[model samples]
Target: MDFMGFFTKKSSKDTAKERLQLILIHDRATVSPELLDNIKEEIMSVISKYVEIDKDELEITMTTSDEEEGNSPALVANIPIKKMLKRR
Candidate 1:
């Protein structure tokens, strides 16, 4: 099996589906698209200083965890790090 193909890139349809999913997540959280985009940009800017990441593969979502513990909203970031930079 060609495992490398899996992570190299995402197809246009796949990208669109991911975007739609993100929009749905934002809608559920009652957050505007622009706000989420701004948040994503700020996060990427701060994280970029410490490590190299795959921007294309990055994903941020609003979710709730542990139903027993009150379903409070949470921001989840899935950042694919390409490399970790040494401390300056």
Candidate 2:
């Protein structure tokens, strides 16, 4: 019994590749790539006009992907913002 076949199995790079492919498809469908930055800037500007927010600490991003073709819209986003706390 040769154990070489087990070790010779093709590496499972499919997961990563599929994820990337999905991301690309999502990017193509969504307007995120075109106006995401502008939207962030506008949000910052508008919010700044009313209150003070640390732009450096602010984060805005767009995430989109395909779950199933023609099933529904393919667009999503994961935005996170961290605020700096000053020591008194």
Best by TM-score: 1
Q: Whole-model lDDT for model 2 versus the true structure?
A: 0.57
- Model 1: CA > 4 A from native: 1-25, 67-69
Specify the highest-lDDT model's number.
1
lDDT of 1: 0.83
Error of 2 at 11 (Å): 20
Residue 63 in candidate 2 has what lDDT?
43
Which RMSD does model 1 reach against the true structure?
5.1
lDDT of 2 by residue, 4-87 (tens): 854664546965775676666556657555576787777877665555576776765444433555444333432333443353
Tens digits of per-residue lDDT for model 1 on 55-87? Answer: 999988776555786765678899999999998
Worst 10 residues of 2 by lDDT: 72-81
List runs of model 2 lying over 4 Å from the truth.
1-28, 32-34, 64-88
